[model samples]
Target: MSVTESKAKTSVKTSKKNVKPAEAAALKEALEAAQIELVPLSALIKSPLNVRTIPYPVESVRELAESIETIGLIQNLVVHTLPEGMSGVAAGGRRLAALQLLLTENRIDAGYQVIVKRVSDELAVVASMVENNQRVAMHPAEQIAGFRKLSEQGKSPAQIGDQLGYGSRHVQRMLKLAHLAPEILELLANNTLDVEQCQALSLESDQARQVQVYEQVKAAYSTVSAHLIKRVITETEISVTHPRFVFIGRETYEAAGGVVREDLFSQEENDGTADRVLVDRLVMEKLETAALAIELNEDWSWSIGRENPLQNYGEDRENYLLLPVPEPQYTPDEQQRLDELYATQAATETYEDEAAIQVLIDEIESQAAHRQWTDEQKASCGVVACLHNGELCILRGIQKKVKTPGEADAATQATSRDLHVIDRKEPDAAEGISLPLLKKCLPNAHWLFRLPWYNSHRKQWP
Candidate 1:
């Protein structure tokens, strides 16, 4: 037998033994006296005695209408007779509004009959209060389970939302939560994990990963935040905004079979990629290709690519001389165009326009500042192409050979002596000068010691 049938039979058997004859008779009478009638849609009106005086949200009314359209009304409106052949809905004000909405939309005619339980004026207020107050909302876990069941039944999220009066995105989120680790779901059911924490955990598709993060969070802090959970979950993954990821761009990375997962709970445009190794490989390959192109096109001796050459080379970077490239002289037409751009930039009132104009000016100047090495420099030097702030950075005319020990030693000794002399004079100078100001002046004092007047008076110092 069906569970409902079995339960019904059990209820009948229990009532037969427990219910008194007089009590049964009274219930039968009460059911008969309660007047249920089919009232026309045009005759229904909101009663002033309704306990819900606050206006229903527009979305609530719309959702109610959608529910009614899907399965028709499930509950009868409790209403009372009015003075002019109309009925005032004392209990179901929102229901009456939803019916009116349907009528206004031409989905239902004004003459359509509505099921209403007619109540006396004296009992109307009580009925309205009872209907509004005497209800329990379903738990979130139960709602999620129901949504999952519907999804298993081949119902799309949009279809389920239309039938149940929920937004599609809300249904989608609940569906995602339903797929979380069993342990996490149990915690959610028991009120240990909240909706937000569950949402964060759902970002990881693997149940093992979700459980691992949850246990780590539980061990670390007494109170776990959604942000903390997400951070822990995505710590090993590369962020979409990472320099290499941004340089590659989303479309290209996806085309290369790199998967990106978007963080729905994040306030900003945050996303993560699982393929960190692939991204690094692609970045290096692209950088090397760019370096090769620059070497061939510019007639340089050689070129190499490094992610961050400065950090990689460390103190050795000092041995290479970075040749300064002068900006090219603008032609007459180029000069006139630049003058017009400057005037437009000055006249622009909005910050956005000013920023755009500045970008244009910078681009033009960058093109003009292209490095042109002499034939001798090209044969002896090479270029280093590296990444800086998600963009390609080219260090041109970097000396290929290291400096001689004699030259390096002489430079270091001069620097050390200059610093030592400044340190010695600082104590006496501190008596009259602010320490910060004196410290700032000391770095520039190396040039001061080379002055003829200062050298002539050097013997006067203590």
Candidate 2:
């Protein structure tokens, strides 16, 4: 109107030029590859996807939101619509979490526009599994168990490979451990063995030989890894069963900390005892200090510590380091891997998969080139995940930068309604023993042989 009071003309202004063409093209390609389309969060209110499948680290999303506060949601998730309308999260739960943070801060509109990719139904599921396997960092036990469940549910290695975007060999390796003998499995369950170690055991043609090696290695119980054991087995051409003894000597001092009482125990002491002295399981908790709890299979394994040889050593309990049966110390060698993958936690459902993942990664990265791969590479050029439910439960491919199958828009969406909490209760004691757990409604039950947790390194000392 000011252009000319009499002419009524308007001026057309243009934005500055000279933008980065490559950056623009890259952004467009990324958005397209990720299958991003504009949509609203209300549409994703009740996604059918279980977050378990798409696990990630909370820290990652927090970092992303921090970036978003300065920048913006650079990309979006891929989703599909139900019969009614555009709805549900398909893949990219982590991405959604990042965007939500911005909305919560009022930095973005409550119902702002969001871009998403329309992933296929099959891709949706595959993406979810990838998120968990790689990002969530699936536990060794869970990986084996999940594969077994899939197989039991009529899925084969090839099928699992196809669904989870794993190579047939990769799936086969995991399946190999899943089919180990019960003894081998028992060691794994008890944190005495790992998957590669189990895989190494599988190489033995003779089942008896495998068991012998297992027992011997377990007996020696050093931190030597499964791969090292494999090398030794192949190089030495020796029987897998190599006997290792538990040799621990404690020096008792009489005044001035001088050595007085010294005893060396043989392997036989692991399970046998000289006499029957009732052990009242007690939690010797020191104020301001770490509480002491004795668990046979936990710290001082009863299999090696129930000898009761040290009980009658002295009347002054203060001057003596009173130990329950075994002293709960692993030989320096095997102690290194006591916290390895598949190692069960004392009071948690979580499992560590670091070593197991390391093993699997070594196998996957050494493959041939120029092959048509079924899986696509990961989003951030590799993996990005979170710790959920107290553990890294996801098992996705980071090195391969690969994406799994079974992806599509999630039809249902869910937010964490509540956090998981471990219920702590005092052990019910009976007959000087507090039952760690009551079986068959027996509130008072004491177990045999105990190893105190104070010296928890190896904690399986004999």
Candidate 3:
């Protein structure tokens, strides 16, 4: 017999020996009312009175089988006698199914014996209901402690999960909770901090820091949110979505000895945070290299790289002019394809399909033309490479030369005429001039000239 069965038999014998005369008679009567026997696995059938109507998951049954194989069944099935020597199980239906699974897998023989408590037919329903209703689930903290104990016993997460009918990742998550600071664990046990808050704390491996943050938040707010806890813990770190981190890329950043702390609860695969200084330096280096390449390939007079060009330049941004990008010219066949793509995009039923079609359209458009810079423009204009929305953006035709007052007035006149051409209905052409120019005849229209239709008509300008 297994250790479990031996202990069970020993306990029963001890209980019988300790019973008094009156109690012994009552025990005998109860034993006669419900007999315990070793019934054949094949002889047990699911009873009509079994409270659990929903079928057990296949994974649940498989895990149960693994548990039974490792440690013999600890509980006995409750069954009632039926005709022709068959017994209907009212309780422990999952256990019965698991045993059958083991038999089917050849882990156990077809004649394997299952321990069962045989009761009267009328008591079967009561037994099933009581068995299900009277049980209390283990608390999360207690579950975590149990998993930790199993881990301490040298069992791998996979093995522990198999015995407990949990996924290996779930077991690992619970084990992480086990490593939390004693104070944090106490908070979890006493319901002061929820599981999610503890999970947020787990992102920080330093128990001291976790406790510090917990105490700080507890004092600062009446109630703490999981997001707030995570933010406080990771305040100094750069999120994966940060422009610098995105520009450097996770692989390159890691290669440079940067560490990333991942959020296990996040649905996004790459959701994590990293050190800001390391990622910022990497971003600057990569941007500088990209700018150098662009300057050499395009024959620009000068090129400068900045993490954030607008922020770095500040008020000085007004000194330079942003040249508009030229429209792409496509052949008849390509244009037809583009039109068809747009039509299909408009009719697309799903966002995924529309995005895919847009990609194809972009590919065709990109092949049609490349940006061109006039020789005069190249001599006076430079390029600025900067990070925008986590992408490397190259701004060409950035005029660096300051304009003379006479030249500025002439340029303003030209802009006025162009604006007039656009809005022909306006009686006074001067009214078409942008507000910034009226305030001060600023030569650079980078800040004020932002009409959406201006790009398509840029080539028409003098």
**Candidate lDDT values, in order:** 0.65, 0.40, 0.66
* Regions of model 3 farther than 4 Å from truth: 1-136, 241-244, 267-270, 308-317, 324-371, 402-462
The candidate 1 region of ten consecutive residues with least summed lDDT is 420-429
TM-score of each: 0.56, 0.29, 0.53
| Candidate 3 TM-score over all chains jointly | 0.53
Candidate 1 lDDT over residue span 1-462, tens digit each: 000111122211100122234534543464358877899899889875554544566898999999998999998888888988988897788888898999999999999889988766645644554355343233455556656766776778776555454556666767887888888877776667777778789889899989999889889988777789988887767888788888878877888888887665454644555578878877887788887887888788888877874432335444544554443456677668767876776676675875576566655554454443577878786777778667777666666434577787676444333221111110121122223332344666767667753553354333
Q: How far is candidate 3 from the true structure (C-alpha RMSD, Å)?
A: 17.9
Q: Which candidate is the best by lDDT?
A: 3
**Model 2: per-residue Cα lDDT over 266-377, one tens digit each:** 1222221110111111101110011112221122211111212212123212112221211223444434443432132223332243333334322222221101222332
Position 57, candidate 3: lDDT: 73
TM-score of 1: 0.56
Estimate the overall C-alpha local distance difference test score of candidate 2.
Answer: 0.40
Which of the two, 1 or 3, has more TM-score? 1
